[model samples]
Target: MITAIVVALLFAMLVIGTPVALALAVSGSLGLYMMGGTPMLMGILETTPLSTASSYELITIPMFILMAEFVVLSGVADDLFDAAAAWIGRLRGGLAMATALAGAGFGAISGSSTASAATLSSTTIPAMLRQGYEPKLATGVVAISGTLAMLIPPSIALILYGIIADVNIGDLLIGGVIPGLLVTLTIILTVAFLVWQDPARAPAGRSYTLREKLSKLRVVAPLLLLFLLVTGTIYSGIATPTEASGIGAFGALVLVALARRLSFGAVRASLLRSAEATCMILFIVLGAHIFGYFFTLTRTTNDLVALIGTLEVSRWAILAIIMVGYLILGCFMDQIAILILTVPIVLPVIQSLGFDPVWFGVLVVVTAEVGMVTPPLGLNAFVVARYTRRPLGEIFGGILPHFWAHLIVIALIAAFPAIVTWLPSTMGR
Candidate 1:
């Protein structure tokens, strides 16, 4: 009964256009009322948001976000994309491949999927279109590749999953490396395959001399340094993820200053944007905590776990089902909301079935990456479409091959847990 009310209220709020965070909070409060009456509901209202927002690790989110904003505003993305283009743009469908690689590099610092999509789309789509790249392929590459922001290290989603699941944040961060690279390689190969099949759409390559290539490297040098500093600090245990983020943010500011891109106006704008994004994410997290607490009080998660345990399905079968469910849900929901709202319920079942929380976290992130490219609610696709001024369908069609690439990589990760676990485990996490 409590579960039913909570579900209904949540859907009702969503359907009526309540902000997602508020909807979660409202539904959670209603669930508490259903389970423990008014006083408990009020108590939840007081404590849950405070507790959820008070997390020290979560501080990394806004700092990383700020770093991304500075990078974007400071024109780092353009330089990075140019560097990628100089090296790879001579191959068939090279621009698209370059976009994917650039997305991976930007993902390192940005950590936010939507921001990545928006920033990269703004930076790359216009150049691709101007270069006579097919609108569908160009937009698709940008949209799908932007999903990398979530799989790469310093990802806000991975960090949140670690916090909620009690998994090591460092391990979760390291765990993303292999899967992230796999997705990148898969997307690149998919682009190659598509270009081979449809030669007309494949533009002739632009040849660059060795001097040109070497000169372009200068454009990306700062980014490489920033990557080393952030990921290096974390992996070396020189700083926690939060401290690494702080260092990265400071580094970004310095980069922007050196690039002569930093101004009082840019700084103010970045801060405002960061604050807005931080509020949206933190609010959803707080609401999810309330909802999770209410669900626990109603014993729904425990009941669901017990019921699933009674089923005759194998653990892998159940895992497959959960991934499919997340894929469908990802199409309509924001990834952060999906992670917060579902992880609490799904994770217990996963653990009961004897899966490692670390592995499952990576699985969940990769699945959510698929959602970012799926249609209707695919935030990345929408952003790309808006930036390129292309029809949504074209962008959707273009991203299809890359979507399969993501799926193939996901399968590899599923079949071989070592792919995702090796780095983090070797790190002794």
Candidate 2:
């Protein structure tokens, strides 16, 4: 009953527009008090903040955020889109395809989906619009492509999942590579199909000469090198994910400096933004730890796992139900918040069913990618709408095809976990 009340209180606070971190902290503390008096709550509060903030793994968040900020400020995203356009712009719906390809490339550097969305919106949407591409197609491609960042290596979403699930952070990062590429390929194919259905919706872009196309590659070489350095180090076991983040940040800093784009203002802005984002995530972590303490005291996960063991349903059915629940929740909540809040509850059950946590981590992020563009609170959709000034309805409608693509990708990963596990398994071998 106490567990039920605490969970109810948490949801009540969320429905009333309470900040997620605060909602978690308050409801958890209240639960702790109800069960074991003020001391238990106080003791938890005193330790959780320190412990959560002090996690060394958490350093990856800020470094990667700062690296992304630097890369954005350096105008590499513009060059990335341009480079992709040069290679693929001659095809039907070519610019839209370029946007997807560039989105995946940008995801290699910037792990934040909304950041990827905003950047693509500024760079690709106008280019597509100027080319006479349909607004719905243009905006939809940008919004959906943005989600590639969530699955790609250096992905903030996967990093958070790793930290939360106590899984190998390196393996999780490596695991995301193949799945991310698969998503990129699927998104491109979706664009191709959309254009094929009505070429008028996305006319072919100007053809580029060999010289011009080759020259564009020069612009992206630095970004490519940076990506190889970061991921290669981790895969080769030369650096942990956290150390690789520092290397990535430093490399981004150097790239900005070499381009003569570095400035006091840019550096300061990057630091401040990184700090702001880091603090927000840390607070969420703190709240999750507090709530987790209360939850563990309730033995909810263990009981839930045991309850599931007695059920006669096939494990696949249970897994599908869980995936469906994530899709529903993804529409209403932030992806990171969903992971932090739900992983502790669901992971044990997943393990009990004989699923690999690393594979499950990749699957979780893939589902979050779908949520980023889903209605009501599709954060990526909002970001696209903000940048393009399109109606939310049109943006949502535009993403309909891509939304189906995401569902298909999710289904593929679920059916063949090897897609997610293969590359990671090869790491260090």
Candidate 3:
């Protein structure tokens, strides 16, 4: 009863538009106080914040953010889009395909959905529009493609899940590579199908000379090198994720310098933005830890898992229900908030059923991707709409095909968990 009450209170706060971190912290503290009085409350307040905030792995967040910021400042996203256009621009729906390719490449470096969406919106949308692509197709492709960052290596979502679930961060990151690529392929195929069905939606782009395409590759080499430097070290056991983050940050800075795009103002802005984002994430982590303590004290996860074990249904059925629940939640909540809030509750249940947590993590991020383009609270859709000045309806409409494509990718991973786990198994060190 008390556990239900606390959960209700948490949702009540959320429904009332309270900040997620504060909602979690407040409900958790209340639960702790009610269950154990002042002693428990004092103990939690005294220890949770310091421990959560002081996690060394936390350093990776800010460094990666800084790296992304520097890369953004250097305007590499524009170059990536141009390069993608040069290579694939002549195919049917080619410009939209280029957007997907560019988005995947940017996602590799940026690890941010909204950032990817905004950048693609600015660079790709205009070109697609000028090429006579329908507004819905142009905006929809950008919105959905932007979500690739959530599952790609150096992904912020994957890193956060690793820290929260106590999984191997590097292995978790490597695990996402194949799934991410599969998602990229699916999105591209979805674009082709859309164009095939309605040739009027997206016109073919002009062809470029092979030499011009080769030249464009040179401009993207620095980004590819940076991705290799960051991910390769982690895969080869040469650096931990934290160390790679620092290396990535430095590499991005060097790239900016070589491109002659570095400025004092850019550096300051990057630091400020990175610091702000880090603080926000850490605070959410702190809140999640507090709520987690309260939830554990109540034995809710164990009780739920025990209850689940007695059910007559197959594990797969229960898994389907859970996935559906997440899809619904995605429509209403922020993905990171969903991660910190639900992972603690759902992971033990998943493990009890013999599901791999790493595979489940990839599924969670993919569901988040679905949420980003879905209606009501599709954050990526909103970002695309905001940046491209497109009607929200068109943005949502455009994403419908890709949204189904996301569902298909999720089903593929669910059926063949090896798609997510195999790469990680082969990683060095």
* Top model number, lDDT: 2
| Per-model lDDT | 0.86, 0.92, 0.91
Q: Encode model 3's per-residue lDDT on 120-219: one tens digit a residue.
A: 8899999998989999999998999999988897899999999999988998888988998899899899999999999999887889998999999997
Shift of residue 228 alpha carbon in model 1, Å: 1.4
The whole-model C-alpha lDDT of candidate 1 against the native structure comes to: 0.86
Error of 1 at 186 (Å): 0.7
Error of 1 at 110 (Å): 1.4
lDDT of 2 at 401: 96
Query: What is candidate 2's TM-score against the reference?
Result: 0.99
Identify the runs in model 1 with alpha carbons over 4 angstroms from their true place. Answer: none
> How does model 3 fare in lDDT?
0.91
What does candidate 1's lDDT look like per residue over 1-429, in tens digits?
Answer: 668877988988887778888998888887788777889988878777678888998898899889888877778888888889999999988988898899999898778788788888888888777778778778888888898989998788998899888788888998898888888888888888888989767686688999999999997878888987888788878888889999999998989899888789989999999999999889888888887888888788899999998999788899989999999999888888888888999999999999989999999999999999898888888888777688888989998888877887888899899988888866732
Backbone clashes in candidate 3 total 0
Candidate 1 at 165: error in angstroms? 1.7
Instruction: Tell me the spans in candidate 2 whose CA falls farther than 4 Å from its real position.
Output: none
